[model samples]
Target chain A: MISKEEAAQEAGWIERCQRGEQEAFAPLVERYRSAVFRVVYRVVRRRDEVEDIVQEVFIKAFTAIRSYNFQSSFQTWLSRIALNHCYDYLRRVRASHVTYFWQMSEEGQRNLEATAESREPGGLNAEQRAAVRELASQVLEAAPPADRVLLALKEIEGHSVEEIGEILDLKPSTVKVRLHRARKRLLKEVSSRARVRPGEPAGAPRP
Target chain B: MRCDHVLEILAEGDPRAREIKEHLAQCPACAARARAWRLAQAGFRELASEPVPEASVGFTPRLMRRLAESSRPAPAEQSFFEKVGRRFVYSTLMLALLALLALAVPRSGPLRSPNSAELMLMQPSVATLQDESVLNVDGLGSHWPHNSTVTAPAAGGQR
Candidate 1:
């Protein structure tokens, strides 16, 4: 949440931008660059492409700055543009069959299974957390682009359904349905891809 | 409850959360589904804990440069419809000018073919005037013969 003063300042910058002042846009970009980068990185999981996508998102926002009517926060508006750019990037990546650096190795797979099956009580250790991150990355790669983005937003980024709906221009109920389906699909992928010991099935319930 | 329904309830966090606990105890399949959901949730929690990447140094400068470049307009490349519309306007203007010329030409000068009577009246000679006594010259009496084609008529009197 932002204070009213900050919002007014941002509105001033946006108003200047709408009047064709390019310099006013710099402050807005500097303010939201990190947040947009984090979201793009979480969704795309591609460190190399995140910067480029973030730049495109800002340029798009500035280009369409006139359409903004202060209906939503500037961050939410920027987030919508970022997610749309990520979707396009994911589609292009899918079409080009590009390989990602986060593809889980054999050791990563083993660590992932061990971490999931571990019966430890409290917070996960660093190694277990790394394993889980690896598994999340793998799941993101295997899932379709839409599901990948939704899962990243809801699960990894910890955004609420209402926030996600605002970002994606979806109803809260629709966001709920989509989030449920994405989780189920990703779980199915993990079950099929992650291996189990001999005479035991994958994704077996905890004893 | 069916395993799928149980999973849906679990995923959605339905208010009837107690029902799922009972169903999990009764059905092994549902129990497995519930366990998988827990593991997945755990994985998500861990993933969420992972550090978020920050913008690198000079990111703003680089982005501003890119924005400056994007702000620069490209050389104008007209679309097919625009080209057609331009041509249409030019053609309409030309047609209007042609129509105006057509309307002004006959009013400015006598460009139409003259009839024989008008031709004879235009180039009258003294001999033709004498030969045709009934021919009126310079608006004189109809039956009188004029001596010369270029003769001047007395003011307010017959030539």
Candidate 2:
């Protein structure tokens, strides 16, 4: 983890870069690349596009580094840059008629579809597995956009609440509440589809 | 405590542990609920644990190159204005320090003049009377015509 003081010191390199001291920026890049890559990978998901997005994130960060006030850690600031790029890419993808599933290699697409199909909870028998897989795909297709994003970040990417908050610009408490609600909604959908009786809801209403 | 409340705490952990311990001391029903919630949470945790894919091998170098390219200096040389700006900042800072020192030090003192006679005359109680005849000898003395005795005002009088 980069400390506030360390980030501040690195900011001096940005000032140098602004003055045309290009070499000063190498260490800054080395320190923050992994943090930035993790954010981009979480959103974009595709291996090929991850590099392009990561590159774009650094370019954006370099162009805007002067405006950074050092209020947050450089890692947090870099994460925001990567996240914004990922969201922009997602939005662009959504606006176009292109389907991400279609863009993937056949094997990749098959694996992803397989995962989606078998997402149902509880151990299932052979017949039940097939039925549950079919139903899981339908439920996922029906899930809200925000819920899907939350699930991808929390469950698929395995991000901690604090990390998600930094990436999403949400408070930790808010992230927890949203994640808890997202899981409950997914659970409710699965339970409803299974026609299985729920013992009780997972958690109480958040104050 | 309500089962709902106990379940919420159990979902989060230690907070629910303490709550359950206290509730169990009195209410067996809520305590039982806590135990069930804990078991469920543990099971969910196990199911949720999946290995994330490793970051691609070339990611670091590719990122570094991108960052390097973005931070690269312009092909054109530094303009005269930029050079002047840097010098201006340094000069301004140095000048400010000098200005501060000038303001802090006492300006009036014996080091400023070779003659000590004026300093001796400025003593609080000393009254030096210069004869007008000495001024007449030193110069044509056209201003001493009225022979008025000019004396320093007494202490505390406005000059």
Candidate 3:
């Protein structure tokens, strides 16, 4: 949470930027870099793409700083930009036949290697964990971008309906509806693949 | 559980958040669906939480460079319509300003006057207007001498 003093400081930087001080944005970036990266990473899981998207988000925020209304906190406003870029990346990937991939950095590759070996609750084997990750990625890719975005924002990022609505330009009710549908779609996909019936434990064979 | 009931529970997220907890407590199917939904959410959240990447040390500089390039007067960044409209407006304004400038300012020394080229361009138009046919000052267009006592003709004079 940002303190009042911090928010005020942030507002000062934003006002400076809005007044045409382009470098004023650097301080703002320093302040919110981790937050914006975390929120964007929730939507775009590809480690290589995350940094590029984060940079694009800041570039966009800087370009559109003049249009930033102080209605919401700068964090909220920034999140909106990050999420929009994530959706655009998803759409571009969907529309293009050729894949746009970046070679993962050392940190990213190390983390991937680590997660590839990490096991979740229920003590799934390394192969099972990889399958889960692969299946999860596929579900995200298969679901509509909007749905996937709402799912990530709500379930993972824990944004409220109104906040998600503000970020995505949907009404609160629409956010709820969409998120619900997204959850159902993802659940359907997971269950279909795993054949896990209601009340049945995961990995159990279907009758 | 009903489909709407299940979705509402899923949307509620963490059935403990609302009275949905009581409903989930009573309905086994709703509870099962909730667990399933949670597992599904956890599935993706797991991947999302795998690792976060930060912008490199030079990210800000690169982004600022990109921003500057975009905001600078780059035609490729502008839309086709905008490019056409801007070009048209700019060309028209330049011509209009040049024409007005040529007529307003005297044709001073070529080396001294910045608008010398514009004045040169307007010279032909001025000469065309000065033609005897173009400037039909036919009525007593005589130059009256102010040095002498003779007064300039006030009434209409014979051609």
TM-score of each: 0.68, 0.46, 0.61
Where is model 2 chain A poorest over a 10-residue stretch in terms of lDDT? Answer: A197-206
Better of 2 and 3 by lDDT: 3
**Which parts of model 1 are misplaced by more than 4 Å?**
A100-111, A118-123, A195-207, B12-15, B74-159
* lDDT tens digits by residue: candidate 1, B12-119: 578887877776667655554455565566667776776767878998888788888778754356456568888999999999999999997654435632232354
As for candidate 2, its clashing pairs are none
Which model scores highest in lDDT? 1
Task: List runs of model 2 lying over 4 Å from the truth.
Answer: A2-9, A18-22, A97-149, A152-163, A188-207, B1-159
Can you list each candidate's DockQ?
0.16, 0.03, 0.15
lDDT of 1 at B42: 67
Cα miss at B45, model 3 (Å)?
Answer: 4.5
Model 2: number of clashes? 0
- The true-versus-predicted C-alpha distance at residue A69 of model 2, in Å, is 1.7
TM-score of 1: 0.68
Kindly report the docking quality category of candidate 1. incorrect
Residue by residue across B91-110, what tens digits does model 2's lDDT show? 99999999987764423334
User: Mind listing the fnat for each candidate?
Assistant: 0.36, 0.06, 0.34
